[model samples]
Structure formats: C-alpha cells, structure tokens
Target: MKDQGRSPRKRTGGRRRPNHKKKKHELGREPTETQVGDQKLKVVDSRGNTQKVRAVTTDVASVADGAETVEATIENVVENPSNPNYARRNIITKGAIVETSEGEARVTSRPGQDGQVNAVLVE
Candidate 1:
C-alpha cells in the first residue's frame, strides 16, 4: 500500500525517523485507468462506511451540448493533459478530449471515481 502521510523530514532539512508504522487510514490505492470497452464497474469500500463506484471500462458517455444532453458512444481518446501515453492507451479521465458519436468532447467528470463518463461538446 502507498503511504498518504506527511514526509519524514523536517523543514530545516533534517532527517526524521517514523515513530509508528503505516496506518490503515493513511493508506492509498492505485489509480483506476478507465478504458473504452463494454461497461464494467467495480464497487470499492471507502472511509466512513461509504462506497465508491469505479468504472473499469465503458463505451458510453453523457455528452452535454449546451441546452441538451445526449448519450453518445465513445470512439477513442484524442488527447489527455494528464499523460500523453494515456491518450495512446485509450484511457479516459477528466479534461481528456474524446471522440464521441455526436462529436469531439472534453470530459467533465471522473469516470474512475464516478463510474460514468460525463463530457461537454467541444467546437
């Protein structure tokens, strides 16, 4: 597991040893790289008894075109600001430019965390 705690260093650039072992609450998980394919979802446990729905793979997207929203078939990822390789791998993430049945759109929601792709039509 990855540690989500503070760094083991002082502001004065002095080394500081950890006093305790890693805790459950301070653990982090790997990123969910959502891809375009048949709809697949995974439910994960979150803090405070909440649940998180993650999209593993999906082919649909809700694309908002100003006054109306329509369900569009995702064709492929066009560009990704997060990583250039993500676009090549067809991974979907927020702010990514994707080609849909309606047109090109910019993703407005996190599919990995929201379990669905939401995007806005781009000119």
Candidate 2:
C-alpha cells in the first residue's frame, strides 16, 4: 500500500488543520516489474519529462572485484529480506545475495530501478 499523510497524534495546543487533498505528485506507488530469467526491459514515464527503465527479466550480472569486473550469468537469488517471495521468485534487487557463474555475489545495484544488475563477488 502507498504511504498516506495523516495528522500527528501528539499535537500541542488547539490547532486546526486545513483540509488537504492528495496531489498527483504526492501519490506513492509500488514497482510492479519483477526481474528474472532472460533480459527484458520496459520504459516507464516518471514525474519529470523523462523515462525510467525497468527490467522485466534478467539473466546476467556484472560482477566486480577489487579491480576487475566481469559479466556473469545469474543463477538464482540467494536471499531477500525486503520480500521473502522475491527470493523464491528469483527477483533481483539491491543488497540481495545472488549466485553467479563466478561464485556467490551480493547485488550492488537495483535492477528494477537501474534496468541492469551489478554485483560484487563475495569471499
């Protein structure tokens, strides 16, 4: 659910609040795309005169070490506390540990937001 603005419960003095209506800019929404499997992308309209790239499905990740970076195939999502179902569904997100061709890696970038998956190999 989207976060809505409400009046504070711990208020001092007898103050009245004006009736405020929800604005289009203040509207909150959840991301629908869940990246998994092969690579797929979608362009979404944002607040400004720009577009946001959303990854629908992805099978590759750029795994980086100290000074080396390599593109590796994604195996699976290891853990995801943001959403337990995401791990089972293999959805890639920032901070999620994922298995790659190189080895186990921790995702460093938001695939859903960045439209690309980037990870760091873990020891």
Candidate 3:
C-alpha cells in the first residue's frame, strides 16, 4: 500500500516525524480507466451514505468552447501526460488531450470521480 503522508524532512536538513499513522481517508484507490465502449458506471461507498463514481467505459464527452458546450463522440485519446499507457488505453482523465468528433480537446474534469468526461476545445 502507498503511504499518503507528509515527508519527514524540512528544507534546511531538519527531521520532522509523522504525528500519526496513515488514516483510512488517506488510503489511495485504484485509478479508473474511462475507455470507449458501452457505458458502465460503478458506485463506491464512501464514509457515509454518499457514493463515489467510477467510470468503466464511456463513449461521449462534453466539450466546451467559449460560450458553447456540446456533447461529442469521443474518438480517441491523443495524449496523456499523466501516463502514456492511458493514451494507448484511451483512459480519460484531467489534463488528457483527447480527440473528439468536433476536434481535439483538453479534458478538464476528473472522469473517475465525476463519472463523466468534460473537456475544453484546444482550437
């Protein structure tokens, strides 16, 4: 498991130990891959009755350009700075450049958490 805690070091070579162990809320979850296919969504239970959304497969994207926002068919992932494999797998994530029916757009929303892909046109 990954440790999601602050580092034990200061800027001037000082040591700062952790105050407490990792909490349940600090646990990291597996990344969701929003690929092209039939729509499939997964609901994950959180602290309370609230749920988290995980997109398994998605075929559409909401592309916004200036004053207009339109739904477009996702063609493919053009580039993904987060992970190259994500581009090959067509996983949708924030900052990912995707090709849509309208044009190339930069994803601005977290699809794994939002359960939907929202992007802004790149020109």
Candidate 4:
C-alpha cells in the first residue's frame, strides 16, 4: 500500500486530544490552564450588591498554599453546587488567601468531573 501519511489525528481508532498549542485565552495566555483557568469581564451580584467581576478561578487538582491561594474581598459558598463534592450537600463557606485580579476570591474544593468545574463563584 502507498503511504497514507498522518491521519486527521494520530491514532486510527482512539480518542482525540485538543491542540493545546493553538489555544488563545482571553488573558493573552497560551494554555497555562493548569495553573489558572479562564478570564472574563462581567457584572455579578455580590452580597445583594452589584459589582464588576474582572477575573475567575479555574479548577485545580491541588493548591500551592491555602493561606496564599484564595484571596477574595467577599466569599460565597455555592449551595447545591454542581461539583460532586458539594453537589450532594451544602458546602461550608470560608475565605482563603489567594491573589486574583478581582482582589482575593476563595478557592474551594472543586468537584472535578467530566473534565469541567462543577461550581465556582466570581466576586
């Protein structure tokens, strides 16, 4: 047979992977998603007040430091969260010490499943 060359993907009968090198994030960051998720500007209701939300948090497997991870001016625990951990019950709300552009938002345990974040609060 002649050389078939490379297929649309490498494997002939396997799952496909996203081309990470071609990703263009809003923050002008190329695929450093493991460390941070995505960034978007939006208006949200915080503490019965409306405020401009600038940054967001991505679901991570492990955090570097708790005291230096979640840093938010306000903290909100998502009840009945989509995350598996919190999805089944009400999670406790506590502020961490992370540094974000929006100030310091708490980075709580995310219910990582189906390759997505189950719940997160932006404030």
Q: What lDDT does the true structure give each of the candidates?
A: 0.94, 0.82, 0.87, 0.32
Q: For residues 1-123, could you state the per-residue lDDT of candidate 2 as single tens digits?
A: 335776544376555564677788778568755566888888888777988788889898999988999999998889886888989888888888898999989988887777888899989
| lDDT (10s digit) by residue, model 3, range 1-123 | 455666789988899988878788877788787787767899988766799888888878999999999999888899999999989988888999999998999999888897898999997
lDDT of 4 by residue, 2-54 (tens): 23223546555775565434322212322111123332223333333544342
What are the per-residue Cα lDDT tens digits for candidate 1 across 1-123?
Answer: 455566878999998887788787876789999999999999999888899999999999999999999999999999999999999999999999999999999999999998999999999
Candidates, ranked, lDDT: 1, 3, 2, 4
Which runs in model 1 stand beyond 4 Å of their true positions? 1-3, 7-18
Task: Look at candidate 2 and give me any clashing residue pairs.
Answer: none
Could you say which candidate leads in TM-score?
1
lDDT of 1 at 4: 59
- RMSD per model, one decimal: 2.6, 3.6, 2.9, 16.0
Worst 10 residues of 2 by lDDT: 1-10
Candidate 3 residue runs with Cα over 4 Å from true position: 1-3
lDDT of 2 at 84: 86
TM-score of each: 0.86, 0.81, 0.85, 0.19
Query: How high is the lDDT of residue 100 in model 1?
Result: 98
